[model samples]
Target: MAGAEWESLEQCLEKNLPLADLREVKRILYGKETRELHLPSGAFEAASKGDFELRGYGFEAAEEQQRRPRIVRVGLVQNRTPLPTDTPVVKQVTALHRRIEAITEVAATCGVNIICFQEAWTMPFAFCTRERLPWTEFAESAEDGPTIRFCQELARKHDMVVVSPILERDAEHGDVLWNTAVVISNSGAVLGKTRKNHIPRVGDFNESTYYMEGNLGHPVFQTQFGRIAVNICYGRHHPLNWLMYSINGAEIIFNPSATVGALSESLWPIEARNAAIANHCFTCAINRVGEERFPNEFTSGDGKKAHRDFGYFYGSSYVAAPDGSRTPGLSRNRDGLLVTELDLNLCRQMTGRYKMYARELTEAVKPNYSPNIMKE
Candidate 1:
């Protein structure tokens, strides 16, 4: 099926639903004070013209006697591929650069202190095809790839920290590839990189065919905004993945993902909200929008007919707070930017009293494991 037909089917399915308004659901799940922020008039006009949803929300923090509030605005970008999957790699990269740069410029206007794009935001979602030729060509150096270079320029121009998730081609380590998120500081310095800890083998998500589980453990990058970490895609399903990042001193965690609606839409809002409440840290979950069509057919090993598309991605990208409060997500069908203002002091306030309990519990787990079995 073509992309337009798939989208029309999605619309038909959505119109028959009895689901509540997402904003109302979030307000009830979080508190009444979990309200929206009104952006400048120009921002609204730009979103309307660009055909992308733009929203802003603020998470309030309690008054602290000792420390002042550390406020930072964060932007999350969820977009579709600008070109066809069969496009040349250089042209694909160039088109994506131009597209993301426009969105980043809008984010800068909102005074965003930090920004993040969805998983593999530069290219089409081609892992389903499993072709080693052009798909693997998307993998580039995490340190100085075209994607990172473009992001560096954006970060420097806006003085905003950028979390760029890309397929990485490691030159030093036998040219192995990894699904990685590269952190670029506000000064445009290459801070460090973290690989995806979990690889999904479910359905058409054959990510493990491209790269193995990451070697780098959960390491938090301290930026000018706050101490942040990236939990790429499938890692969001693991509670331990969320816990380890918090244990490593990550105040905010971004899960850059590209999951289809049919497979994991039900669990989308639940996991990140649960993680925020459980870990006592902010969680930002992002997913790309729109349906991507591939040139060849693929199967999910479920006795179903081979298909060319992976269904709709359902881009309801959201930000969950440490106090279980969250902002309403972007639309499921269009490109979007979710701008949220977070007070970093809230993490400390929520987690301060419970830190000892978490530490003790984690320490207690060490003795339960058998020493005879090698750790994974």
Candidate 2:
């Protein structure tokens, strides 16, 4: 589809929801349980004129005598590389920083408490090319990398927690690389980080050539907004990855990813939504948009001819609440920001209703499984 058509469709869907009861329209198009929030007029105007798409949704839970409602607004950003993948590392990084910075400024106007970027937001999704030198150049120290420093400033300025997924270079440990996400607190302090537990070798996702499995296990960071965790990229395909984050007391889990349409588009919506329902926690699935072409041709090892680019990175970023209800996703082909307000109390409400004793079940089933295979 053309760019203009996609923008028109996005605006129509976003505007029509607030104008009328579109339950039937939503049921026919977006899922039946989807809900949207009416945002300020300035947000829509910003999206109409800016370089990115904007959307908002709100989820609520029942009131209680013991505790008040804990509403936290979250922002998920999906964007394409502003420059070509073959551009110089510094130039490419600078272009991405500018793109994300502008979108984030708009998110701050929407009063987002926490915001997350698509996986490898500072660089192109070039791992599929499997060429080492230039791609490896993108990896940097998570503690004080240029990307983290940029995000820290925005977090501090907006008083919003930021989840930044990047290719981490463990400078202290032989400069080993890991797929990691750094969590910046609202105060701009580095709360902690989580590394992707699973790596993919499927299709053109030649990720193992770049980095091995991560050393850091699932660790949740307690930010000023809420307790959250990052399940970076391929880790979303693993059920245990999601379960462990919930076990670590993560109220919200962000899955920052760089996936293409041909490989996992069908599984994209299902996994995160299912995880939220089963784990009793919120899940934000963020993916970059647009196609990224490389200088050299590469093969997927699937008997297909070599190509210069992987398939399109479908955006479709969205948030799923613990009650199995989700907000509509961002555009599949445009740079977009999805803003949603969630009640953390919904996790507790769902927990009481589901009554799935995951801890007990795991304890009872652990002995029967092989000890070596069960080791984390």
RMSD of 1: 5.0
Angstrom error at residue 230, model 2: 0.6
Give lDDT: candidate 2, residue 299. Answer: 92
Off by over 4 Å in 1: 1-27, 349-376
lDDT of each: 0.86, 0.85
* Candidate whose lDDT is highest: 1
> TM-score of each candidate?
0.88, 0.88
Residue-wise C-alpha lDDT for candidate 1, range 2-117, written one tens digit per residue: 33234333244446645666435435655545667778888878877777778899998998999889998999999989888888998988998888888888888888998999
TM-score of 2: 0.88
Error of 2 at 336 (Å): 0.4
Superposition error at 153 for model 1 (Å): 0.7
Query: For model 2, how does the per-residue alpha-carbon lDDT over 1-376 read when each residue is reduced to its tens digit?
Result: 2332344333577676763556666554445364577778888788778767888888878889998899899999999898988789999999888888888888999999999998878888888888887999999989999999998999999999999999899999899888899999999999988888999988888889888998888899998788999999888888889988998899999999999777787888789988898888999999988888889999988999999988888888989878777887788888899999999998952334223556556665886754435445
